[model samples]
Target: MQQRVLWSAVMVAALVLAGCGSAARPASPSGGPQQEQRKLVVWDWKSGEAATATYVEKVKADFAGRHPGVTVEFVAQPFDQYYTLLGTAAQSRKGPDVMLFNGGGQIRDRVDSLLPLEQHVAQDRSRLAGWDAFTKDGKIYAAPVTLQGHPIYYNKTLYEKAGLDPANPPRTWDEFVRACSAVKKATGAACLALGNKEGFGIQFFMSGLGSGILTPQEYDDWIAGKRDWSSPHVRRIFELWKEAGDKGLNSDGANSTAMFTDVFRVFESGKAAHIIGLMSDVGHWKDFGEFLPPDKLGVMRAPVVTGGATPSLPYDGGIGYAVARWTKDPELAADLVHSLTSADALAAFSSAAGAISSDTTIDVSRAGPAVAAIVPEIRTGRPALHVALSAKTLDLMGRLSQQLLSGSATVDKAVEQLAAADRAG
Candidate 1:
């Protein structure tokens, strides 16, 4: 509800931001330089990272070549305050002309302030994947730069300590539990590395394991907003989430632990045997590979928990670039978004920053075994369950997840709250 309110606040406070836009100026005669040079600002969390230096450079180079008179400034905001800053900017009419956004509800809910990119990015439709994440009302609002997925990653050394074959991970929920149990008994390591301080743990947990719990059709329905929170399958997900904490599968102080680099460290340092990890950005194969041997980073599907449930990949469009509706030149901003997702620029992104380029055509065979494994499954992968939820519901889920972990809330109570939030959305 607070999220909805914040957006409503944006709509009310920034009425002019959405209502007015600068008209497109005619191109200079004989294709010469314009009378007035233009500048576009881009904001994102990734631009400041050392690994993304090449990605940023690539974007600037591509855009500069396309528009010599335009000056583009990159502002890398700290992610914790990203949305707050975005809201303030929208309200103040001082935000970037083009900005980065997470797919799903984050972008969808802000469409009142965004320019739809459907026609602008038509050429990229067939070349890139994960468009559904940034599309609402059949109109695309951004261009995806990377595809993100939750793949169960295990430490081969930890598997060996559990007396399990490193090459063959468990294929069923029962076997998975036994493996966790064995790891706990043999090495004193937590079975899984979990951090939920910000409630992101449950988000990863739902997406990472949802494939094994929900029937294929039910999974589709959930993504389509036909969620049945009280249904046995839906309730079962919450049940298992609680059960994992009760069983001591996750490391201690799980709720206090940050889900970002901290959770990845828990797995990298071998304090835990496994993690439900991302395909791109941090906490993934490349980040772990920097600390562990490439061969030791293993990717596995969600183990099946219910009869007839098929385990497949779950993912969404990671981060993407969007043009603001208030921009002086929507096409100019859209073109910058285009350059941001260009093949060469994204190829540099994949290799330089360890992101899985949304352009599936990019070869990742040499990235690592884990990525090699994840890429092949992208064709059949489904959007993550949490990604389908609205921002308000996600925040609610995060709180409920913590209560469930600490035995403070029953699965039923959590479901009821979520059902209400979902309906409100």
Candidate 2:
């Protein structure tokens, strides 16, 4: 199948305690005849899912082998409530020994309650590439497990039906619109599948299409904490969002569509030609490959909207594991964190869960051409624009995007709100 174009631990108990500040170790008593069993509680949303069972087991097995007296217990929580639970635990100064986090704002915002893993995972640093997302204030707080980004995935079969060359997908905004018009005219399929009900649709649109509209300097600056939401190029992205809806480029009821599976299903069922999708998890090449044949899948850069906008992949750390600051044994917990990210463990995850492992050493050539095309782009990739936004701003953007599509809000108004929010943070 050839689909072209597309896309650490730990220290001694005493040393860790000193590094992490005072924390009690209930498992190890001051004077006991026999040492009590050590249990390291891990919090994450993925372990309960069947897809990652093997990966979790591999990590547990490895950690158990290294630390005979410790037992690892994974507490799977609903992702929607995971952060809330973590926040509660943080306030109480007690929680799981280890916790899983999505890179970017999620982890960055919560670093105050996490132990810095830089010194502990120094050996693994060179083997990983997504450290930026999990880093804050020059300190690394978590170890990345997957690489996530928004990539434009298209259907070659749809392209062919539209009379467009599959190998030559659109490279510019004008060309993309023409191609979409052709697609709608020939096959009657929507040009793009969008699910904004949760507002993630806007986020994906902003990141996926941003590379084409913003210049390289603008893109870099946005992620570097110097966002210019009022820039004409930046404003253009929001305009396109409304334009896509106004032009009927997206499937019907887009504002009510859920991004997780609804938007993907639209594309999967051949109702739409393209989607702004993830790299590692659901809605990615692997998931799409199930419905569309390898040769029918294509990955593309964001179509160039403004001139001089060099197309570069936009991505950052997908998901990672961080040690809770109030753990009884920081060293032991950090060791488990390192074990979870071990090459062998990540390899199992990549194979079983179809994840794009954070370990750069992991072999992925066998995954397919779509992944092949996406991986190399990392060298020129910049962090996603939305990842830099605070959660509050993202929530606001989602609502504003819906308004834009509905003609209730203009680009100027949306940008004004975003600029205010971004500047506030």
Q: What lDDT, from 0 to 1, does candidate 1 have?
A: 0.89
Model 2 residue runs over 4 Å out of place are 1-37
Residue 190 alpha-carbon offset, candidate 1, angstroms = 1.6
Model 2, 1-425: lDDT tens digits are 13332211223555666786434332222222433439989999999988888898899899989998789999999988999898888867777989999998899888778888888899888888788999998999999899999989999999998788999999988999999999989998999999999999999998998888899999888888988876899888988898899989989999999998888989988999999999887998889888988779999999999999998888998999999876777778889988999999998888678777888677888888888888888878888889989989999999999999889998899999989988998
Decoy 1 TM-score against native:
0.90
* Alpha carbon lDDT at 320, candidate 2: 92
Clash totals, every prediction: 0, 2
Candidate 1 lDDT tens digits, 201-307: 99999999999999999999999879988779988899999999998989999999999869899999999999999988889999899778999989999999998
Query: Would you estimate the TM-scores of all the predictions?
Result: 0.90, 0.89
Lowest summed lDDT across 10 adjacent residues in model 1 is found at 24-33
